[model samples]
Target chain A: MSERAQQLLEIADDELLLGWRNSEWTGIAPFLEEDVAFSSIAQNEIGHARALYELAGRDLGKTADELAFDRAPEEYRSAALVEPRFVPDWARTIARHYLYETADQIRIEALKASDDAEVAGLAAKIDREEVYHRMHAEMWLERLVGEPRVREALVELWPKALGVLGDDLRPLLRERLAALDLPEVEPVERGKHSGELAELWEKMTVVRRSVPGATW
Target chain B: MSAQEQAFLEYVQGGGQVETSDWMPAEYRARLIKFIEMHGNSELMGVLPEREWILRAPTLQRKLALTAKVQDEVGHAQLIYRVVEDLGKPRAACLQDLIDGKSKFHNVFHYPTKSWGDVGVIAWLVDAAAIISQKALLKCSYAPYARIMKKICWEESFHILHGRDVILTMMNGTDEQRTLVQEALDRWWGPLMQFHGNPIAQGDDPSFSWRIKSQSNDEARQQFLDGYVPQIWELGLTVPDPKLRKDEEADRWEYSEPDWAELKHVVTGNGPRTKGRLQLRRTSRAETDWVRRALLAEAA
Candidate 1:
């Protein structure tokens, strides 16, 4: 794959997987208002994924659906941080949400500077939508900061969170964590897939694969 | 009825709206709480059947659309439960009643969703049926609920369009895809027909007497049929009911009567999936109980 296409696939995969994970909380989020708010964040992530996939698809000569659903499990470029199942666990979910949004902002900001106009334009659009997501994540992070369980969840997921960004971007993530007074941890880099991704992929692709090439 | 109660009734029947602080007859207050609480419960429960599909949505666009649709339902529940709270029932109590099977939700939520077909059918037809009932509630005598219904109806417009888009896409695709829509329509038609509730004479229905619901149940059902049946037929799909058709002379759709007994059984918590769904709700609520407490503690 071209460098530009590979970059798009990596970010698109991360957003798609994270969005899928976040959407699991739709009906079962801790409270109704949060359920609605969090679901919008999930939808936004998926929307971001779709745009990114479309951009990549233009390069690969495939449709966004083909990119999103028809790929083999190993072919996906999503980070491990986004691949876990976190439903019914508000603490971890919010922790991941908070961390992911913070990291994603850095990535999106860089993408906005891309030499390719299409990538830069899409990043600008995504950044506009992501404003609310960052606010939502910050709100929850503030609310849950003092809770022991949430603090513990943040501790647990910190390394995975760092995996969402590349080595070049890792220092920025670390600096942001330092600003928040969160502890430094070794990064869980993204080359290897998490065990959860395969399971998630199985469910996510079931309907599409049930009738191959059929419109949903 | 006492003079004051009769006056309140006459006021509502004459199309007067009541605010949260207004003087209301005891029965009106109680009935309004019960009626509105059920609507809230139905919206919450309605999320369950469609949520599973959120994980399995075939395309990114469909996934996002379905998530937004379910999100809207949850948001509607919040709006409705807040209204119920103002009417003297706490949201917690309403949720407790729902979890304990001490309250009712609409029957459509009590059933199972078997496939992607079910997803499209629900968004297209179930939401269509719901929108009809909701449109009628625009003039609800309770100002708060009527106000929220306006937003609810506006949001629902996209759901029906999204649903129709899904169905139309499948219909225009392979035969198996089209079959999915037809099979789903077959499974869902009965619930759609029964969704508006068994017809009750406007004068005899307490909800109508209080102007809580402006239209009769049958009126809502007819509106759904008139608007959607042709859309279904044009797609070459069949509703499960063999006798279902519009009567030209009566200017009404005539059909084999929906099983009111089944409707009662389902709303009363005996449908195929009711027990499992309630259990899921009970368990998830317990799991997240601390999040609520944690937030409340922070607020305090």
Candidate 2:
């Protein structure tokens, strides 16, 4: 694969997996309105993933669905940060939401500066949607920042949050955290898979695998 | 009835609309709340079955569509509960009643969704059945509800399309896929028939007289059959009822009597999946209790 294609797959995989994790709260979110709002965000993440996969698929000669769902778990390039399941835990869910949006904003900003016009254009479009996502996450962050449980959850997930960013973007994330008076933690860098991704892949691909060579 | 309530009834019967702030009889208000609350509860509970498939959706497109569809249902629940809240009960209380089995939702929701095909059938047929009743609500005497029904019906149109697309794709695919759709249809046919409720004369039903429901139970059922049976038949799928057919000369459908006993049994919280689904609702509510408290505290 071309370097551009590989780069796109990494970002796309992160989104696909993160979207999958976020959707786990579809019906059972804390309240009705929030349930609807959060589900939209989940759909948005997957949508962003699909757009990215389509762009990447062009270079790899595959369809977006194939790129998104057909890859082996070992071939998945998602960050460990987006791999864990967080249903029924609003604290950690929000903690992850706030952190991932922060990290994704940084990454998208860099992609928006890419020399490839198509990549740059898609990045710009994704950044437009992420604006609301950021607002939502920041809104929750402001509300829960004063709570001890939220603070603990943020602290607990801080390392994983750092893993979502590359070394170049990690400094920017740290700067943002420092502005919010958040303490820095050791980074859990990307490039490794946990058992969590394998489990998610199992459920995600079960239906598609059941009837091989069938269109759904 | 009191002279005041008698006047209110006659006004509604004569096609008058009632606003939330308008004068209404005590019985009218109570009846409105109960009916609307159950509709809201059904929308909320309806999410559980489809949510499972959102994870297992075969393609990214299917996954996105299913997730958005589920999201729309939750949105519908929110809009519905707001109307109910205006009527008297709070949204939280409605939810509590739902999980406690003190209230009821639609019969179809209480059953299990066994496969990807069930998802398609539900979106196509179950939603088709629901849209029939909801369309009747467009002429409801309660102005607030009738207004919201317009938006709800508009969104339901897309769900039916999505469902038909899913089913059609499966039906056109491999033999295994076709079998999946057929089996799902077989399992769902009973609930779909019972969906509009037992056939009752419009004059005998209180909901119909109040103009809360402008159509009779059998009227809604006939509408559903007229609209969907051909769609089902054209796909080479059987209706699972040997007696089901259109009576052209009589201008009505002739079918075996729906199992009213089972409809009552399932909706009363004894269906195959009701206990497990409600238990999930109860547990999730308990787990999120602190989140609501903390968030509300901050807002206050």
Candidate 3:
């Protein structure tokens, strides 16, 4: 794959997996209003992934859905941060939400400076939606920052959150964490698939794989 | 009825609407709460069956669409629970009653969704059935619910289109895919027929007398048949009912008597999947109790 295509897939895979993880809270969020609000955020992530895949598909000669779903779990370039399930655990979920959006802002800002106009344009579009996601996460963080469980969740997931961006972006993520009084931790790098991603892949592709070569 | 209560009934019957500040007869308010609360409960419980498909939707488009559809149901539940809340019962109490099995949702939600075909059938036909009843509520005497139904019905139209798209694509594919739709339709037909509840004359039903529902149980069922059966048959899908037919002479549909017994059994919380779904709700609620507390404390 071209370097640009590979880079696109990496970000697309992250959004796809993160959206899938977040959507698990659709029906069962702590409250109804939050449930609706959170699901919209999940949909926005998937939408961003689809647009990224479509751009990458041009280089790879594949459809967006093919790039998104047809790959083996091992081939996925998503970071470990998004692979874990967080349902029924609002504290951890919000921790991941706040951290991922923070890290993602750094990644997206760099992409917005890409030489390729298509990539830069898409990055701009995604950042616009991410504005709401950031506000949502920050709102929750403000509300629950004093709670012990929220603090513990942030501390535990800090390393994985840093892993979402590259070394160049990690410094920026650290700067944001410092602003929030979050402690810095060692990074858990990507390039490895967790068992949880495998399980998620199984459920995600079950119906599509049931009858191969047939349109859903 | 007391003279005052009779006048209230007459007012509602004469196209009058009630707001939160209006004075209503105690019985009307109580029944209205129960009825509307059940609608809210159904919208919430309805999410369970569909959310399973959100994770399993066959393609990225399917996945996103299914997730949004489920999200809309949750949104509807929120809107409905707000209406219920204004009517006196709080949202938490309604949710508590639902988990306790002391309240009822619609019967269709109690059954299991066994396949992707079930997803299409539900999004297509199940939602189609619901839209019929909801459209009647467009004239609901409670103006708040009536207004919300307008939005709900608009969203439901998109769901039906999405569902039809799913079913049609499958039906146009391999024989195995067609079999999936047929099998799902067969299993769901009975519940769909029973969905609007047992037949009752419009004038005799209290909900009708108060203008909460402008249509009777059978009228809604007939409308569902009139609208959907032709579409189903045009696609070469069987109705799964040997006796289902419209009698043009009477302008009504006649079919095998729906298993009223099963409808009763299910809505009373004895369907095949009722216990498990409710238990899932209970467990999730308990797990998230602390989050609510933190929010309340922050607000205070």
Number of the candidate with higher TM-score, 1 or 2:
2
Candidate 1 lDDT, tens digit per residue, B1-300? 999989888898899999999999889999999999999999999999999899999988899889999999999999999999999999999999999999999898999999898999999888999999899899999999999999999999999999999999999999899888888888988888889999988989989989999999999988889999998889888878889888999999989999899898888889999999999999999999999998888889
Tens digits of per-residue lDDT, candidate 2, A1-216, equal 899998899999999999999999999998887888788998999999999999999889999999988889999988878998889889989999999999999999999999999999999999999999999999988888888888888888888888888788899998888856677677886768899999999999998999998999
**Model 1, stretches more than 4 Å misplaced?**
A179-185
**Chain A superposition TM-score per model:** 0.96, 0.96, 0.97
Comparing 1 with 3 on lDDT, the higher-scoring candidate is: 3
Error of 1 at B102 (Å): 1.1
Q: Per-prediction DockQ scores?
A: 0.86, 0.90, 0.89
Which residue runs of candidate 3 sit more than 4 Å off their true CA positions? A180-184
Question: B252, model 1: CA deviation in Å?
Answer: 2.1
Residues A69-107, model 1: lDDT tens digits: 999999998888899898888899989999999999999
| Superior candidate under DockQ, 2 versus 3 | 2
User: Relative to the unseen true structure, what is the C-alpha lDDT of residue A184 in candidate 2, on a scale of 0 to 100?
Assistant: 61
**Candidate 2: which stretches are off by over 4 Å?**
A180-184
